[model samples]
Target chain A: MNTAILSGRELNYQYNRSQRQPEGGKAALANLSFDLFPGQFLALLGPNGAGKSTLFALLTQLLRLQQGDILVDGTSIRQARSAALKSMGVVFQQSTLDPDLTVIQNLNYYAALHGMSSREARARSLVELERLQLGDAAGKKIRHLNGGHQRRVEIARALLHRPRLLLLDEATAGLDLETRANINRHVRDLCQQQGIAVLWATHLIDEVEAADQVMILHRGNKLAQNRCEELLLEHHCDRLIDLFGRLTGTQTGELTT
Target chain B: MNLATASYCFLGIFKRELHRFLQQRARFASALVRPLLWLLVFAAGFRAALGIAIIPPYETYITYEVYITPGLVGIILLFNSMQSSLSMVYDREMGSMKVLLTSPMPRSYLLLCKILSTSLVSLLQVYTFLLIAALFDIVMPASGYFWLLPAVLLASLMLCSLGLLLSILIKQLENFAGVMNFVVFPMFFLSSALYPLWRMRESSEFIYLVCLYNPFTHAVELIRFALYASLNLPALGVTAAVTAVLLFAAISAYQPRNRPQRGKPPS
Candidate 1:
């Protein structure tokens, strides 16, 4: 088998007492492990408070790992943080784009952060922006664009460096149906065409396709890890939502009928 | 990374700050107006009550306006540094900070670049204030204007570091108002920015002691000396040492292990 581009080994994390508003020092994640190879899309399926974001935080180095190790393209994040971060691009759940700057301007700023030369930054920014169908709106301020377009700008920014891995933290949390599908299709196409490994986290069942790899998490524990169709076949369930309901013991509101 | 990459990163941050600063027209106007008011109104009103003395940095007896020019410059640096750091808190809440932290560079280096960018922004306002002071005939020695550049920049970096340390401690935007009242006021009022140490000693020995201990006092003294094309060794030593400590401390506060307790629940 080809070496996995992303490897998360026995990952564990817990919130401390001071961090607890009501529940303190509970395990936010427990002995979770996963791997993704190039051109693969792994849908991290979980509801609210299921430790999806906590795992994302740890993977992105936003939160330091309490226990376990994350290796991005063979570099341990703990041992070589800069090298580990260098191999991946991330789209945070919250909008990180500057609203006052134009869409292209935002891309250019991120290009600089990645240490890309001005010539390369402009060239890559245009390619990504056009691919995402954001070319015409390049000069428009971020505040002037709709929520979906802003998210697309963010995706374009993340891709400017052409990372081996792409991490999306609820990239479609709040969006119209058509926009969500458009983003979903775009990310999938990127994974296929560029051979980029994708770790997509979401609570929505529809976001997970039948052929995609899926990991079901509940209360910081992995309930299942397999292809969507395989998991459904193994559980004797007809739909992904039914399988999720059986595992997490809770119903999610974002299911697409 | 290489020097070319590092330099571009700095340029990117500088460009972004420049854009934001230019867009906020009121911010520049307000920064100047505060110091100008003190130089024109408060200094004029206090000239009759406060007598001038030939301080170490001053050659002879000087007017109240000349005496307090550096102090007004201190006020500008103090306020601007705090305001710039306050934006960090805003950025953290608004999520832009994550973008910065995620850069494929050392976290400490990224933060230093951030502080440097903001300090550069504050320096612009400082120079503007100095220019206006010069127009009002409150000019420094000829080379003093040039000398003030490095002196004020060092002073500005120290103040920005202290403000960044405070920003890490302060969790919410609502609580930053308390910093203005507590941190800014105490540093400005308890320093030689407004009165001489001897004069302060006459009023209360405790206040005098506090003024001597405050880092802002050393920063003001440094600026005062540099503006006259002279260097105060002791003041320079204190200001530089404190800046190193505060900057190191601020950078440590962002490191993964020491990062302020992030108990935010998973969304």
Candidate 2:
């Protein structure tokens, strides 16, 4: 029940901000480490500039792991890249779907990439689209859809392969409050119903629930990692947002330990 | 990925490229117009000015229109391949490339599929141009048209590989326009595309050497000879060798650094 589907160990990465500076001045992610258990939702709570997307990039193999290692479904990403990649799905921060193509076309293309037959691709895509309440818009171009709809299409596309691990990097950014909450809650339900591990990265404090596993990330540092309620209890805080506020803003939220 | 998966991946990429090419009506128009203008207007003007000696590809003195048709074919291919790759740069900027790179296949295999797909689309455009040229009475030998198919596909692959390499190396989409100018223009102008090397040699020995050494010259020679029901061994060797090198380099360089910067949440 506690088997980890995703494991990131001592991961470190630096952005080369300038040509003259050899190895870069500041590290984007410095010695970060965590594990995401199967059927569990890991909320990576971090503000802007908190190395959330960098970590996501590394996990998705969009960026090379500069230091340490990452494993997906017991396969090291650095070693067996294709096998590791086969085990996960990622919905990046930006809209990655081609605007000119219809939603179904995009989903079909993704299915083909994973070697699914056309019959199977259609079946799986229809199931995901219906679940996302996007069945009617399947034939419409991505550009014709609104932001919330487009995002929903992306989520459907991501899940068509039924990967064991799903990684979303600020997936609900810039949406309205209702849409944001809906997307957040929907993704949370996926972990429970589908038995898929999820690593959801976001800055919004309210996106996380009191029962979820939350990790506070700031300036490439993991400030705290525990259940939401336990973190509030341990930090002597009334709510999750206060702990988040204290840790992320100003002269740091000094941890009791 | 397994062989079956790789084949499916290739089919997906091929269909997507063909779909995109078909959707963009203006792209097809522009691709045809560029070559047609050179063939109809430019070649027509230069016919009397540029006399052709009996080139090897031509057993006798060929009309200037016939001589330049193969070069015009080269133009369509060079521009089409580069245009296909320019869309790659656009995909990078638009973040669709990240989606592609993250697919459950080897990066090298994915890139290879992309090259083949674009080459196939470019082939369609080339054949369309040939059909239009035939309508205008600029016809090659009957068998030459059939034989030119393989040569055209090979040339398109090499040119597409070069374009893909440029797309990877070109960091910004804005920088790609400048690169196309530097690469496409010099390749077309300095090659045996427009005029015979002997003609260039007569004008300037230095210019002749550049044309002789330019890989585009060999590409054109291959197409020209193939269109005349003949074969050029040297051109075939050069094109095949260069395709291997460029393809290897492009696939190898498509690592982390070559990928476009992801839209981070301001970190």
Local distance difference test, each candidate: 0.87, 0.85
lDDT of 2 at A105: 85
Inter-residue clash pairs, candidate 1: none
The DockQ figures for the candidates are 0.63, 0.51
Residue-level lDDT of model 2, residues A168-235, one tens digit each, is 98888889989988898888889999888899988777788888999888889898999999999998
Per-residue error (Å), model 1, residue A247: 1.9
lDDT of 2: 0.85
Per-residue lDDT over A211-233 for candidate 1, one digit per residue giving the tens place of the 0 to 100 score: 99999888899999999999999
Off by over 4 Å in 2: A17-24, A248-257, B257-267
TM for candidate 1 is: 0.97
- State in Å the error of residue A78, model 2: 1.5
Candidate 1 lDDT over B1-267, as tens digits, reads 999989888888877888888888998999999989999999999999999789888989888988888888998989888887888888888887888888987888888887788888988898888888888888888998889888888899899899889988888999998998899999999999888999999999999999999999999999999989999999999999999999999999888788744567533
Candidate 2 scores a C-alpha RMSD against the true structure in Å of: 2.9
